[model samples]
Target: MLEYLTSLNDHNLPYPDTIHPIVVHFVIAMVLFGFIWDVLGYFTGKTQLFEVGWWNMFVATIAMFVAIIFGQFEAGLAQPYSVAKSVLNLHTLVGWSLSGIITAITAWRYVIRSRNPQKLPIYYLGAGLILTLIVGVQVYLGDKLVWVYGLHTVPVVEALKDGLLR
Candidate 1:
């Protein structure tokens, strides 16, 4: 069972890179750009940009869930060093919470888009800005997990295999 689970990270497939980061960049780009395009559309009265924002948010809503799934899978396999445990736990919590938050916001955006595709309400834009801010914080947390704590990196994985990391 342990061998089977560890084999999922074997890097033998066509896309050998970590799956979480691949999926997550899509979420990050879509959410941030979706908010940006919406704000620009609101201020400049460009209805076309609203279309762009709506689509971006819609795709981001989906991609964020995919990213969260891979994140949970990879995090489960991670054996972080003692000092890194709290940060990993926090990142996992935020990742799951962000998934739910993005889903709710996307549903709200869908309603607004369905009613009137051209104009977005100020409250919705405000909420999107807040969502973008939260995403930024999540990005920071993810960076700390990978860069500062070195989770799943080659060296870290080697250390784990050698029982050098707790």
Candidate 2:
């Protein structure tokens, strides 16, 4: 068990590729699309769009936890260097925070949906906007981890193995 656990691919992941990014992308898309749907529903007065938004947020809230689980596992395998550490830490923090925020927002949406279902309050829209902004910041931090720091990439892994990154 320990031996198998210690063995990892060139990308430093036990799996073939990074699952975190794959799952996180879905969460990101759903959250953004859900917010868009809500905005459209609010403007167009199409209650059906609210249903779309509600389902999206519901799934996104669940998927966020899955993404966070994979993220934590992958981060454990990342072996980030000095500069990448802070960014990785920030990303981890934000990811965890998002899970809670998304869950709370979804719950709030559920109450609104249950009570009226036909109308969305202005504050909910504002909350969606705020969530979108936070998601944007998280995306930037994640991008920095991958693009700038090159965490878990082939070259970075090779460099680490060669004792080139300290």
Candidate 3:
């Protein structure tokens, strides 16, 4: 994914900025942390989390929308990168699916039961932790799709064309 994203450039002109990739990485990391929190709840016993109601789920789900915006924005600036087209499509599909599942699970307790998260029966935190790892894998896959494949001609290219690679 990094290879593909690194290959972004309309008219073969490399992007000359860095904000997009850094921000995208930051956001993805944050989202993963949220899932980690959920996973923590499943393991080591029913750990306590602030019953912030829908706010917790809301932010995580909304992050997906933000990621899509950044993704499309970067893609727009770096056209003709065929790898992005395919990865972007897959990314969007997986993101929406994950968000939907998260919402559904949260809603079951928040909306249907009309109860606070604290009142709901505890679930296995291992499931959530496993999911957190899975999310990381997805993000890594996106990176590989862009980088490993995009950098065939320029192996040292930074994934962030217009922004800081770090």
Candidate 4:
């Protein structure tokens, strides 16, 4: 599987496989979104998307872990564009940190949800707040990579240079 993953990381084009990094970006975004929405809903005395089906959030959180692994590899060593290695390293570190945060939050929430579903508002609120802040930081770091660190913007010359014809 490690070899398979390494081989798959090279096809950074826009094909099905090539688009995986983009999907990882989305997974990060969605996990943040879900966490934030749940937090806001809790404070406002409202019900959010994950408020009902905690199971789905668990599944998505797992998916986020997987996506982050793939994205980290691609961001570090995927072909062409040649993003700054340090910047992507920062991205990977931030991602792993978020995963840790999510795992801890998920565990705490699991205990809370199973104990008393109706009275879980307070516990959920705290978790949501922590998660929101973490995600917010992750988003900012991502933006920095894209704009300032050249992680997101690929030079056309590099793209063409990496093209098969070249």
Candidate 5:
């Protein structure tokens, strides 16, 4: 088991491709969609939209944790170069923070729903907007890690192996 775990591919991953991004994308979509649904529900007075938004937030809260777990595991295997290290560290911090934020937001949403399922408060909508912006920032940081830093890309891994990148 240890031997198999130690044997990593050219991307410095045990598996073929990164799983963190895949899981994280789901979390991002759910969060963004949830905010949109809540806003629409608030404006149009459609309670069903609130239901949809609640479910999305609920699932997003759960998925965020899963994404964090996979992200931590993949990051441990990333072997990021010096330039990528700072961005990776920031991404890690934000990811963990987002998980907490999402969970808290979901809990707040639950309380709101329990009190009034038909109408969402304006303050909650404001919080949703804030959460969406934070998610956008997180997405940008994540994109930087992959596009600019190329932490787990084939060429980057090869360069690291050849001692080209410090």
Candidate 6:
């Protein structure tokens, strides 16, 4: 049982890079584009774009949850130390928060779509814009974990194995 659980780590994955990032990019793009299309559709009075936005938000909502699950799993196996710990914690916090936020927004979007697919309310767009900003911050936190701290990098892994990080 322990071996099976251990084998679920990022290192044991078939790919060289982690799966979280791959899955996360989809969430990012979909959410961003979803909000964009909604905003554009609202201004342009384009029903077609609203349709696009609704589907995008729908898919993004599902993908964000998938990303969060993989993120939590990968984060558990990260074995972060020292400075990376704070970053990882923050990233995890925001990741979960964003998942909820996105889900809520998607629900709101769904209702708005069902009621009036022709356009979204200004306040909803405002909330989406705010969500976009939060997503930007989340991206920054993720970047710091990978680029600045090298959480799962080969050298960092070697360092951890050698007792260089604690």
In every candidate, how many clashes are there? 0, 0, 25, 0, 0, 0
- lDDT (Cα, tens digit) per residue for candidate 6, span 67-143: 98888877877788888999899999999899899999999988988887776789998998999999999999999
Instruction: Report RMSD (Å) for each prediction in the order shown.
Output: 3.0, 1.4, 8.2, 5.5, 1.1, 2.4
TM-score ranking of the models: 5, 2, 6, 1, 4, 3
Candidate 4: C-alpha lDDT: 0.59
- What's model 2's TM-score? 0.96
lDDT of each: 0.85, 0.95, 0.52, 0.59, 0.93, 0.86
For 1-166, candidate 5 gives per-residue lDDT tens digits of 8977779998899888999999999999999999999999888888899999999999999999999998999999888889999999999999999998999999999999999899899999899999999999999999999999998899999999999998
Residue-level lDDT tens digits of model 1 in 8-120: 44332123557898899899999999999999999999989998998999999899889988888777777677989998888888888888999999999989988999889
lDDT measured at residue 131 in model 4 versus the true structure, 0 to 100: 71
- lDDT, candidate 3, 33-108, per-residue tens: 5555554553434535424323555565666566666655655554324545676567657655666665565555
Candidate 2 residue 131 Cα shift, in angstroms, is: 0.2
Candidate 5 Cα deviation (angstroms), residue 28: 0.3
lDDT of 4 by residue, 43-138 (tens): 565654446436545755787777786676556444323444565676678788777877777777678677865445666666666777777776
Q: List candidate 4 stretches off by more than 4 Å.
A: 1-21, 40-50, 53-56, 78-83, 121-123, 152-166
> Candidate 1 at 157: error in angstroms?
1.2
Over all chains combined, what TM-score does candidate 3 have? Answer: 0.55
Q: Cα deviation in Å at residue 147, candidate 4?
A: 3.1
* Candidate 2, 23-59: lDDT as tens digits: 9999999999999999999999999999999999999
